[model samples]
Target: METIIVENIYKYYPAATKKERNKALNGISFTVKNGEIFGLIGPDGAGKTSLFHILTTLLLADGGRATVDGFDVVKDYKQIRKRVGYMPGRFSLYQDLTVEENLQFFATAFETTVEKNLDLIHEIYIQLEPFKKRRAGKLSGGMKQKLALCCALIHKPSVLFLDEPTTGVDPVSRKEFWQMLKSLQLQGITTIVSTPYMDEANLCDRIGLLQNGSLLGIDTPENLTRNFGKPLFALKAEQMYPLLLHMRAYDQTATCYGFGDYHHITFIDPHIQQADIRSYLQGVGFTEPVEIRQIAPGIEDCFMDLLNH
Candidate 1:
């Protein structure tokens, strides 16, 4: 079953001079299935946050319509709020309140108690229990994130929306948090998470790649990477910086970008031989043992390919 449906959603922010409005979201559309973890993957200012606010009914879209669990975002906002849980990009809990107090408050707001929904958040709650008396503002970054997540889930919501949940947290905490989400999925709760990290795209059941308030593509990570229909190679030399410039200047290079330790390149002519590239690099003053080999496209590669086209 489709748990959430967004159709041609559009949102705009007025500028001071009124010459041009900031198009936060432009005709964006996608659907989330029940019991699935759907991801909106993009960099900052890509309209991921704006789209989240619209679906959560915190902000209204100027055009188009969205329904969460069959309740329209505008007409049935009250019903949607009751059924869905939202964790904004910012930590929004009462900072002065203790960890336990914050959780209790959110539970009360939902007309429920912590104990009533304890089973729903046991894995996460146990981590926060030791710091139950600690003021939310005094907790560490990872702790604050866990506490926020606990509060959002205290209501046993059927659908959950998490916006940039791991943006500033430590890597270990990010891994743990995603594990918690995976556990939540087993309970049949649909989740929608927006993230700027390209690596996290593979964690979701499916992802929508958004850029400049537009969706570039939507599909499973494996399929999206597979669709990047070009022979890709990774090259590296003793002088990494100089190799990048040389690769870009090459006649056969289609796309060349620095990726970690290696410079990833795609050939404009697929029939070009690797031996030819080696010879070219050697002629360009690169010594022997210059590394160049075929490599598969990753999620970032696919995203860049989409952006380039």
Candidate 2:
């Protein structure tokens, strides 16, 4: 079952000058399956939040159509709102309200009570129980995240939309949050989450790589990496920036981008060996102990590859 369907959705915003419009979403189309975790992976300004607002019926698209839980995003927004849970990119919960008060507020807004959906949020709520009396603004980043999630799930929504749920969260909290998502899948709740962190792509069942308001590709994380057909290598030297420039200027270099301690490069000619790269750098007066090795492409690598093309 397709829990959510988005077809040729378009959204535009006014630019600095009144004569021009910025395209926030450009013909975005995809289907999220029932009980599937679909991730929108990209950097900021990729229109993740814009798309989220459209699906959650908080913002209307300029063109195209979308349906959440079989309700049209524009026309049947009221029905959609009742069946779907949405956690915006920012913390939108009442700051002055205590954690318990915030949860109850959302539940009441949805015409439901926390007690009725206690089982849905039990795993997450327990973590926030000790701080239940604390004001939302006074809690830690992780605690605020938990409280927001609990409130979102208070109504036992059929589909959950989380926009950048793990951004600014601690490493441990990010791990714990993903675990909670996986647990939600067991209960047959569909999730659509967006994040700028490429590493989080692996946590989803399938991911759509979005960039500059367009989707580059959609596939399972494993398949996306497996399909990176070019020969890729990681090169490291004492002088990082200089090495990156040299690699980009190489005749056979298809793509070169810095990846933390090393610069990842893909060869235009697959036959080019790792030894060839080392030799070229050395020939260019790069006397530093250069290290070059063929390495498997990751989600970030795939995303960069897509961006390059």
**Per-residue alpha-carbon lDDT of candidate 1 for residues 163-209, written as tens digits (9 for 90 to 100):** 99999777788899999999999999999999988888999999999
Per-candidate alpha-carbon RMSD to the true structure:
1.0, 1.5
Over 45-103, each residue of candidate 2 has an lDDT whose tens digit, in order, gives 99999999999888999999998988999889999989999898899999999998999
What's model 2's TM-score? 0.96
Identify the candidate with maximal lDDT: 1
lDDT of 1 at 57: 90
| Cα lDDT listed for each candidate | 0.93, 0.92
Best model per TM-score: 1
